[model samples]
Structure formats: structure tokens, C-alpha cells
Target: MLILGGTGDATVLAVRASEIPGVDVITALAGRTRQPTVLSENTRIGGFGGVAGLTNYLREQQIDLLIDATHPFAAQISFNAAAAAATTGILHLMLIRPAWNPTTGDRWIDVESNQAAATVLPGLAQRIFLTIGRQELAPFAHLQAPSLDTRNKSLLASQAIDLWFLIRMIDPPPPDVAIPPGKILLARGPFSLEEERSLLQQYEIGAIVSKNSGGDATYAKIRAARELMIPVVMIQRPSVPSGEQVETLETAVAWIRKQLAIRA
Candidate 1:
């Protein structure tokens, strides 16, 4: 089995399925993160060059099945998985975590993309806590970065482009990136309630921003903000093309087992 594992659920699923009686599990990680993890029995880091590299890996490794449990925003890799599955005649499954839905007392501001989220920043609140992950932040920076070169007035209609951002990503944000001063927090979470509380007080955070990466690991911040009556700005998960997507580790394991049983 070949598991494209990077997201927390993907990592859990890959690690759990490694114990199957006759199955050999190989997990490919995006390797954007440098932290240590309890991954599967066999692991390879970094991208597989695109569709061609991925297809070659599938064929060379004799992978019988492929599972795409990547981050919700990893569109290109997901596309590669779809195409490779078709080309190699191997089974594929996508494990997508359920997106967070609205509930009472949740001050949710929905945006189409990260860029849209950036645009919404001015009026919503200036002192914000952003949890939209490292790579997805590019859209916001692109919209916000000031350059003297040419006119890109299309994105400047609102003039709300001057809003400040306090970004907190898993890894240290890119130094080369153009972010406003005194606005970057280098940290990872499952942020503790106390920690979140402290941050809210320290930063005087009026708004919280996040993606619906549903799980206990990183939810404390949201809870803290809610208690403090801070508004939360959320970016909804991107839609994945139609597929059999199981969310939990248990279900993912069961689905893989059923596929193996059917093959037998």
C-alpha cells in the first residue's frame, strides 16, 4: 500500500495500517515540515516530481493501492494521485477530514480563498491570529506585498489592503517573504488553553483566524477566542473532487482492509 500521508489524520492512518498481516505500507510525506513524527513503517519525504515521478514510483514500487490523505489544500498532489491511479490501474482513496461547520456564538467570517481572507482583514479586526498553514499564506502575501513596479489596481479596489496580520504557522515563516513588522508569531499547536489565553492577552487579539482542520490537537485557540468573545475568521476547506473519502483513522483502516479483502 502507498499512502500519501502528511496531514495529522493521514499520519495516523498510515501508522495504523502498517500492522496489516501481509500488507507493506509506504508513506510519502510532503517534507515541508522538519519535525519528528511517528510515521509508517517505511517513509519517503518530499515531492515525487509531479505526475511522472509519482507514476514511476507507483510502478517501480509495485504499489497495489494508493491513498491520498493529504492536506485539504494540496490540490496538485491530489491531481497527480488521481491521474496516476488511472494510469497505473491501481486503487485510490482520499481521506478528508470533515470541515468545521457554523454553530451559535461562532463569529465566523467565510472567505473564498486565503486572498479573500486577507481582503476581509481591515474591517473585521486588525489584530488577528492566523492559522491558515504556511503554504496557503502565499495568497495573502501576494495581495498585501507593496512594490513600486507596475500597477495591479484590480486587487486594490477596496484599499483595505493595508490591514495588518499576525500569522502563526507550524514552521518559521519565510524570512524572504514581505510581512509587516511586529506581526509574526512563530509557533505550533495544539495550543494549550492557558497558552492561547496568554497569547490573546499578550497580543490583545481581537480576532482569530483559522482553517477547519478538525481535531483536538489545535482547537484550544478557537475555544479560547470564543471564551474571550473574540471573532473568528475562518477559511473553509477547498472542495475535493468526488471520491470515497473517509475521515477517521479507524474508518481509513477499515476501508483499506475491505479493499484488500475484495482483492483476495
Candidate 2:
């Protein structure tokens, strides 16, 4: 079995699936980070080109099952995985976690893309807490204080928006990339509620911009934002290729067992 993995769910699935008797599990990462958490000794890092390269890898490795456990926003790779599985005629599964939804007292403005989020920021708040990872910083790069000559605009547009962003990411983006105008906070997830609240308070964050990736690892920020009454600009997940998907780890395990049984 080959697991396209990078998220926490992917890591857990890799470890659990490897423990199944008589099964060989290999996890592949996109190699976006300098030191990604090693899944096991059989892990391979880097891309598999595209659909063709992935199809070749599946054939050469004699992989019977292909599991996509990538991040919810990793749409392109998910589509590639689906295509490669179709070409190679292998059992494929997508382990997609549910997206987060707004609840009571949560000020959520759902947007379609990062570009939309950037467009709405001027109307939302001045100090923004940007929690989207390092890859998609280009959309927010042009955010800056508006010039004084634009007095004809409405209050939301004429507020002299000194756009300050608190950009948080696990790793710093490539140096050549143009990031938004603000301080970058380098950190990882599973943050405590207190830590998230303190960070928000310390930075005086009036609004937050996040992807609805939906998992407990980073949900603390959402909880903190609710308590602080801070508005959130939530970017919805991008569409992925349709496929047989299971939400929980147990179901994925059961499907694997059934496939292995058929092979046996």
C-alpha cells in the first residue's frame, strides 16, 4: 500500500496501517518542509511528477492500494492521485477530514479563495491574523496602507487601512517570495487555547484569516477568536477529484482489511 501523506491523519494512518500483519506500507511526502516528521523507515520524500509519474511509481512498486491522506487544501495532488489510480487500476481511498463550520458567537465570513480573502480584508479589520500556511502568501502581498487621496471612498474603504498582518506558518516561505507587510511568527500547531488567546491579545489582532482545513491541531485559534469576538475570514476548501472516501481512521482500516482479504 502507498499512502500519500503529510497531515496528522496521514501520519497516524501510516503507523496504524503498517502494524497490520503481512502488510507493507510506504508513505510519500511532498517534501515541502526541510524536516518533515518521518513516518517510518519506508518513507519516500518528494513529488511523483504528475499523474504519469505517479502511475509509473504505482506500477513499479507493485502497490495494490493507494490512499490519499493529504491536507484538505491540497487539491492538485489529490486530483493527481485519483487519476493515477484510475490509470493503474488500483484501489484508491481519500481520507478527507471534515471542514470547520461557524458556531454561535463566531464571526465568520466565508470566502472562496485566498484572493477573495485579501479582497475582503480592507472591509473587515486593520490588524489581521493570517494563519494560512506559507505557500499562498502572494495573494496578500499587495496589502498596504491606503493613500490619503482616496477620501471619496466609504468608511470601510477610506479608513487609512494600515494593514498589519501576523503571519504564522510552520516554516518560513521562500526568501524571494513577497510576503504581506507584517511580522512572521514561525510555529507549529496543537496550540493551547491560552497560547492562542495570548498571541491574539499580544498582537492586538482584530481579525483572522484561515483556511477551513478542519482538525483539532489548529482549532484552538478558532476557539480563542470566538472568545475574543474577533472576526474570521474563512477560506473554503478547494474542490478535489471525486472518489471513494472515508472520514474516520477505523473505516479506512476496515476498507484496507477488506481489500487485503480479497487479495488473500
Candidate 3:
């Protein structure tokens, strides 16, 4: 079995799958983070080039089942996995955590994409807590205070909210990337509500920008926002290819067992 993995649930599934008798599990990592959580199963890092490269790998390895346990926003890899499975005539399944929904007292402004979220930020608040990962930070960089002599006055005025961003990510951003005026917090998640509240207070965050990457690990921030009555600019997830998807690890494990049993 080949599992395309990156999320915490993926790690759980990988560990569970490794324990099953006669199942050969291999987990693939995207290598985005500097130090990824180590998986007990055999692991491969980096991309497979593209769809063609992935298809070639599936054939060469003679994989029986392919499980896409990638991040929900990792649409390209998910699509490639589906296409590669189709080409190889192997069974494919997607294991994804469901997207988050807003409850009462939650001030969430949903936007189609990161760019749209950036466009909406200045109107919402001046002090922003940007929780979206480092890769997507470029879109919001324009929110930084511009030079006084700049000519585009209207553009400057519209963007001139003088936003201050607080970026939180596990890895430090590359030096060449242009980032908004902000302090970066280098940390991993499963963060506590107290810690999140402290962060919001420390930064005096008026608004928060985050992707709807649903799971409990980073959810404290959302709860903190709700408690503080802070508005959140949520970037909606991209659509992924349709397939047999299981939301829970038990169901995924059962599905894998069924496939392995049939093959056995």
C-alpha cells in the first residue's frame, strides 16, 4: 500500500496501517517542513515530479492500493494521485478530515481564495493575525505600510489601513520572500486555548486570517477568536477530485483491510 501523507491524521493512519499483518505500507511526504514528524512506516520524501512521474512510480512499485491522506488544500497531489491510480488500475481512497463550520458568536468571513482574503483584510481590521502558512503569505504582503512618496494615492489609501500582521508558522519563511510587516512565531500546533488567547492579547489582534484546514490541533485559535469577538477571514479550501473518501481512521483501516483481504 502507498499512502500519500502529510497531515496528523495521515500519521495516525500510517502507524495503524503498519501494524496490520502482511500489509506493506509506504508513506510519501511533500517535504515542505524542515523537520516533519517521523513516521514508523517506510517513507519517501519530495514530489514524484508530476502525474507522469507518479504513474511511472505506481507501475514500478506494483502498488496494490493507493491512499491519498494528503492535506485537503493539496489539490494538485490529490488530483495526480487519482490520475495515477486510474492509469495503474489500482484502488484509490481519500482520507480527509472534514472542513470546519462556524457556530453562533463566531465571526467568520469566508473568501474564495487567499488573494480574496488579502483584498478583504484592510476593510476588516488594522491589526491582523495571519495564521495561514508561509507559502500563502505573499498575497497579504501588500497590506504592509507603503513608502510615503508613492504615487498611487487611491491604491495606497484603499490599502493604507496600515495593517500590522503577526504570522505564525512551523518553519521560517525564505529570505527572498516579501512578507508584510509582522513578527513570525516559529511553533507547531496542538496549541492550547490559553496560549492562543495569550497570543491574541499579546498582539492585540483585531482580525485573524486562516485557511479552513479542519482538525483539533490548531482549532484553539478559532475558539480564542470567538471568545475575544475577533473577526476571522477564512480562506475556503480548493475543490479536489472525487473518490471513495473516509473521514475516520477506523473506516480507512477497514477499507484497506477489505482490499488487502481480496488481494490475499
User: lDDT of each structure?
Assistant: 0.76, 0.91, 0.89
Model 3 ranges off by over 4 Å: 144-161
TM-score, ranked from best to worst = 2, 3, 1
Per-residue error for 215 in candidate 3, Å, reads 1.0
Model 3 Cα lDDT, one tens digit per residue, 1-264: 899998999899999999999988888999999998766548999999999999999888888889999998999999999999988889999998989999999999999998899998876787899988888788888774432435643345433455789999999998878888878889999899999999999989999999999999999999999999999999899998988999889999999889888878
Pick by TM-score: which candidate is best? 2
Model 2 stretches with alpha carbons more than 4 Å out = 145-161
Q: What digit string (tens of lDDT, one per residue) describes model 2 on residues 1-264?
A: 999999999999999999999889999999998889888779999999999999999999999999999999989999999999999899999999889989999999999999999999876777899999898899898775553444664354354556899999989899878888899999988899999999999999989999999989999999999999999999999998988999888999999999999989
TM-score of each: 0.86, 0.94, 0.93
Instruction: List clashing residue pairs in candidate 2.
Output: none
| C-alpha lDDT of residue 54 in model 2 | 96
In the range 74-163, model 1's lDDT, one tens digit per residue, is 878998898888889898898877776766667778877777777776556656677776665655553332322246434344344444
Which regions in candidate 1 have their CA more than 4 angstroms from the true location?
Answer: 36-38, 136-164
Decide which is better by lDDT, 2 or 3: 2
